[model samples]
Structure formats: C-alpha cells, structure tokens
Target: MSTTINSFNGDQQQSSSSPDVGDLEKHYIDAKAFILSATTKDGINLYDHLAHCISQLLADQPREGTDLVEDISKTIKSEATPAQHDTLRDRPAPDSEHSLAAEQKPLFEKVDHSEELDDEALQSPLPHILEQAYYFEQAGIGLGKDESYRIWLALKQLADKGQIDKLRFWGKIFGTQKNYFIAEAEQNVDDETDENELHEEAHISDDNRHPNEEEMDDEEDMLPKSTYKPPPVVPKEERGTGANKYTYYVCNHPGGVWVKLPIVTPAQISQARLIKHYFTGDLNKEITSYPAYPGTERNYLRAQVARISATSSVSPAGKFKFSEVN
Candidate 1:
C-alpha cells in the first residue's frame, strides 16, 4: 500500500512538469500566421520584423539603467555635427583680402620732470621750514616731519609754478565729496593784473546780455516802481590786506593740478554767511539755497576759507601790530 501511494505521487509530479503538446502546436501556428501577415504587408523578412519589434521594445522600456557615459557620448556626437557644419560654412577663405599694415602709432613717450622739480624744490626755504617744523612738532604745534616735508615739497612746487613771492600750505578743508588741499600764495603784481584782465574778458557786459535778461528787464519795468532804493553794493577790496590778500590755489590731492580759485566777492561772502551748504567738489556747481549765492562753489569755498582764517588765525605776540597808516 505504501508503494502504490508513492507511485501516485510520482505521476502527479510528472504531469505538473510536462507541457501540453496541443497548446504548443497552437502557439506555433499563431506565431507563424502573424509573421506571414507582417512580412506580406511590410515586405520585410521575419528576421527584420523580429529585429524591429525588439528595437521598439527597447525604446519603450524605461531608461533608468542607461549608461551615463554612453548618453554623454551620443549627446556630444549630436551637437558636434551641426557645429562642424556651421564652422565649415562660415570659415574665412585663406585668400580673403585683409589689411596687414594697421595705422602706424608712435611709441609711448614719457616726459618726467619730477627729479628736476625735486631739485628745485630743495633750493627753496622749504628745507628751513621743515627743520623748524620738527621743533614745532616737539612743542605739539605742527604736523609730523614726514607730513611737513610732503607739504613743503608741494608748496615749493606751487611757488615755482605760480612765480609766487611767498607760498604757504593752507589748512585742508573737508568737503562732502572731496577735500581741498589749499595753498596760499602771494602773487606778483603783473600776474594779478593778467588774472584780472582774463576775468574781465570772461565777464558778460550789459551790451551783450542774453535775450532772457532783456525779457526780465522788461518784466521788471512792467511791475510797480517804488522809491525804496536798496543800498548800493560795496566794492570789492584790494588783494593786499583784505579777504583777497593771497591768491588761493586748491587741488583735491597733492601732485595734482592746482586750480586758482576766483577772487571772492563781497556779495558772495555775505551770501555764504547766510546759508550753509556742503561742498560738492565741483568748482562750477551752483548753490541753491535761501539768499542764493552770487557765485559758484569756488567763490563760496574761498569765502569760507577767508572766514575760517580770520577767525582761527594766530600769531606770536608782537609779531604783528594794527596800523592805520594806510
């Protein structure tokens, strides 16, 4: 009985392992019919049809396992072909005309006079002043030696250039945009005359006034006239002993072009005292404020410097005495 039961179990396992011959024959027939129909319609052999089906299956499959290097190589190949074609088409011909000789330019030329200027600067009284400055520093009354020497050199250069009888380093004035390195110099009589003449040439006369001035005059005439005459404007003082005593040259930095400030007018000084405005570094900048300034920023700066010097200037006792002889 045990042998019979063992035999039955072996038969069941054999039946489960073996495939049905009828089902295999049916699948073979169906595959043959589909291949025949596909070949007849597409005019392609079974092998080509099978290969196309395999390619479609591969294309439809997810690319998650694709090789990164292969993709990059394919991308590079795809992009390189178009670029190569464009490059070949746009390539300049070897025989194309091109100017070989560009416009001839002169070589850079340097004309430095620093050494000569330095030698000349040493010949002035700056050395003596520099020596005295050391003692002044010891007494806590002057800038350090290095700073004093630098200022001395600058002052000497300014004196030589301006043909000044006397030159001194005026204190620096801080501004909003930039600071002024001031140099006070006593000008020669002839130089002052020449500057005055140049200013006269630049001054606009009533005879050649602008049309806008004429219109303004007409408008003033149409207005009601009153007998209230304003006080006559004061004449500008001479350059020897008053606010215009010394010609002021200002530069934003040392070793820069020193600009001679226009002589300050009394009107400018009066107006400057009324309104406070920060300096904009531009000499030609207009001052827009109550009791509008009569001149540009240069005039305003000059007035302020004059005011500061008058208020803060100090001298040793008996160094100067008031006199009414003039």
Candidate 2:
C-alpha cells in the first residue's frame, strides 16, 4: 500500500491553504484506508477529523485564489442568526412600488470583510457531500442506489473526482446485507517462536509484512467475520471451461494460529482442522485445489486466518459471505 500511496502522491503541493491537488488525494486515500481496516475505528466515528480536513480543502479551493486572503479588509458583511434567514433580510418593505430596488441588490449581499473572505474558499469534496446530504434530507428525497462501483475502479475515479455523486449500490445477493459468513482455522506452522520470539524477529520496513503478524489484534476481530464473496462471473470467453481445469480463488486470512469454527458439520470442521496440514505441504493436490462457488454446498474448509496479503490495501465498505462447497 505504501507503493500505491507513493504512486498516487505525486509532486503536487498539498497544504492547509486551499487544497492543492495532492491534499485532495491524501484525504481521498485516507478515507479509503480507514474503511478497509479490520480495526474497530470507523469512518462515521472519525467524521469530525475528516470534516476538519474537508473544511480546509474547501477554504483553499475558491476562485480568488491567494488574492481573496489579501483583499479581506476590503469588504463588510452581516452575521446570520438562527431565527431569521439573513439572505432575505434586506428585502424591500412594500409591494411593486419598490420591486425595482430589490433587483439592484446583489443576490449575496456583502455584509462584512470576514464573510467575504470566507466565501472565497474553494469548494471541497467533503463539504460538497455534506451540503448535498443536508439538502436531500431537508427535501425528504429518495434515489435508487447502485452497487457496481465498490469493485469498479473507473467508475470510482469518476465519482471521487466529482464527475458523479459517489454511488451507493445494492448487491445482487438475495439477502439485504452483502457480507458473507466466514469461518477459518489458524495454526502455528512455520514460526520457531511465541509472541516474544516473533517480536524479536528482524524488522523490514516494506508494506507486505511478509508473514503479516502486525495486524494480529485486528485480525482477531475479523477472525469470526462474515464476508461476501462475489459469485464467480466467468468472462464470456471462459464460460465453457470444465471445473477441474479452472483456477480456484482461495479466500482465507494469512499469518497467526487457531481457527476454531462454530456449528458447521463434523466434515466441514475436519477441513478447517487441516489448515496446518494444507499450509505445511502435507495435503493432497485435489483437496487443496478443491473448486469453490458461492451458495453451493461444496464441502470445503475456511481459512482459519482472515486478512489481506501483508500488502497494504484500501478496502471499500462492501461485504461478502464465505461459503463452503461440498
């Protein structure tokens, strides 16, 4: 994930002063990472911090650029109160007699220097989202939600850059939720040490924590997590391939030990039990290569460990169910 951050973090300047292109990228990237973390910390919880960063981007994004800040002393403005709408405060008193006078006043009247300065900040993605949400809620409106972009990069980019409203999608699965049920087993197969010994192991600064044990705590939380595995959608050209020749996508967590499962049959429990055997090179090729499909009772075992490859990733907030096929 560090490489991904570096690739996207170009030479563009990012500072608190009106969001430079880089600043926008950083917020966008951070938001993605927070959601993917198995850590209990979540987006709604960090909204205040996120709101602050987003506000800065807005303050820095306006038309006047640096000039607005310098010219701040030049304008005057009025304070708006909760009781009355200030924008309409200056309306003409009577009827048609003074109608022409109201047209002469600008739509946004200049009340104070501070207000004018505040108006010049550029529109930021964060505020843009918040403001839109407020208007929609106020009007009590509803719109259809779509789910394809959670996994679609191009569509995501467009939505991120304001070319579209970030979409909310619905999964094709029959259930209301998109996450899948997962039960994996873990084992201490390769290490020569316990927690103390593993801590003393040499450190490498790269992203993929080769034998990723760093997120051990979060991994524990995800241990019993439900996942939503996308049902395999073989491309048009690959449709006729026989099951034996097809490649199976393994969904399991990596690193650590202990994969106790609940309520599955003895046979399925048996598969989870051999997790060590599978990782230790003692399993049959057919057993290890067993085909998997969603919603089918394929007798299979879940990876006791659950996590992304040590490689850092920004997982979007979508879910999948982990199922075993007989």
Best by lDDT: 1
Cα lDDT for residue 274, candidate 2: 43
Q: Candidate 2 lDDT, tens digit per residue, 1-326?
A: 99878755653334334667887899998987775442322222334444544554476687754565433322211111124436656754688435523542332244343544343233221223334444655788522122121222222222233322123211111112212222111212232123521332222123214454566555645565346765543322121132111111121111111122211222333344444322321111234333221111222322222112112335566665468788
Per-model clash counts, in order, read 0, 37
Candidate 1 residues 174-285, lDDT tens each? 7887778888877665666546425643662443353564665667357654678668667777666588888888986555568887677677788888998998888878
Top TM-score hit: 1
Point out where model 2 deviates above 4 Å. 1-83, 86-146, 154-266, 269-326
Give the alpha-carbon lDDT of every model.
Answer: 0.68, 0.31
**For model 1, what is the C-alpha lDDT against the true structure?**
0.68
Supply the TM-score for candidate 2: 0.13
Off by over 4 Å in 1: 1-150, 193-223, 315-326
